[model samples]
Target: MPTTEITHALLAPGESELIEVAGNRIRIIVANPTLLVCDYSAAPHFPGPPLHVHPGFDETYIVLEGRLEVTVAEERRELAPSAAAYVSGSVPHTFDNPGAERARFLSICSPGGFEDFFRAMATGDREAIVGVSERFGYEAVKTRG
Candidate 1:
């Protein structure tokens, strides 16, 4: 079992960097070979980016506080506190927070590496995500996974 607090040997602090994307503060907590956990905080009306799909790792979103607008393929749902959703790998999905309060959520990715993509976004580069799909064992394909 893991220790009570993630110590120095487990993972370094700088290893988990915070990336700011579109007025949202995204912090990568855990990034490993098979699991990835990221914490995201978005101000009210923070519009998410375009819909994208990953062909390798599936994703799960756990809303810690506030509300979120999530779109899995063609279906859209409003998620609140303690609410969660799953999107299989290679599915087109996106999310946004339109409420007045700060929306906080945890994103989990199986087979890891989502943080690389977010880090690229933090650089404020528009085209960084283009090569992300290929770099992180995921293809930016249009197929539903």
Candidate 2:
């Protein structure tokens, strides 16, 4: 649920809400009406989500450590630390860690509300995840380029 009262939020290290999804540790740093920010670390060569889109919001992936392979439509790029990728909500996209070392990154979603998807994903229930995805306009595409 989106916070009814938007306020400042600060997450120190492990203080955030941490959820393990798809073998990745995702810490939700901030979630409010206007933005949602999460910090996550992906295991080496971890395959990310299938090509997907969240039509309700735009997203940005900012690499904090190691390299993250990001694909937006047909274009793929391996981004190093401090590198970032901005993806429009209508674009089909995905990300993974292609390097041998673990990769850390921040995922920022504007007009926040998608954190519920992560929470639902933490339950490891496919049906629930699908419902939440549908509710949030998050959809995995079969063919996108």
Candidate 3:
């Protein structure tokens, strides 16, 4: 078996690549073939993307500040600072800022490349977004209000 090389990166405060998705500002910390890490900040009462599932990787979130309402499958919960949540592959999940202040969190996705979809979305490349979503086996599910 072959071994994968380890990489190192250091980003100062506010130094990461920033992108806007669905009105949320995402700061990309690191994106490699094996992992994608990002910081997400959203305004108060901001609802994130519709329920979605990743067929290829698991996603984890760490709440850094404020509060977030997270929904996974049939369960919903509110996470505060220093809280964490995990959504496995094929599980439908979504999150939103329910607090009165801005919400911030860090997200990590395993087996990387999802950042491509984010970049495409930020650039408003509809075709690329659709293609990347399909290539990465991501599907959105409708949610009832």
**Top-scoring candidate (TM-score):** 3
Clash number for each model: 0, 0, 0
Worst 10 residues of 3 by lDDT: 2-11
The TM-score that candidate 2 achieves is: 0.89
- In the range 16-45, model 2's lDDT, one tens digit per residue, is 889887778888899887898989899888
lDDT per residue (tens digit) for residues 30-138 in model 3: 8888999989898788987789897888999999999999999999999999999999969899999977898999999998888999899888999998998988788
1-145 per-residue lDDT for model 1 (tens digits): 7635433335576666688877888888887767888888987898775677777788899999999999888999999999999998677788889899999999999977778788777785557766775665454234332
- At residue 13, candidate 1 shows an lDDT of 64
* TM-score, cand. 1: 0.78
| Backbone clash pairs in model 3 (N, Cα, C under 3 Å; residues 3+ apart or in different chains), count | 0
TM-scores for the candidates: 0.78, 0.89, 0.90
> lDDT of all predictions, in order shown?
0.80, 0.87, 0.88
Give me the runs in candidate 2 sitting further than 4 Å from their true place.
Answer: 1-3, 143-145
Distance (Å) between predicted and true CA of 41, model 3? Answer: 0.4
- Ten contiguous residues with the weakest lDDT in model 2: 1-10
Model 1 Cα shift for residue 111 (angstroms): 1.2
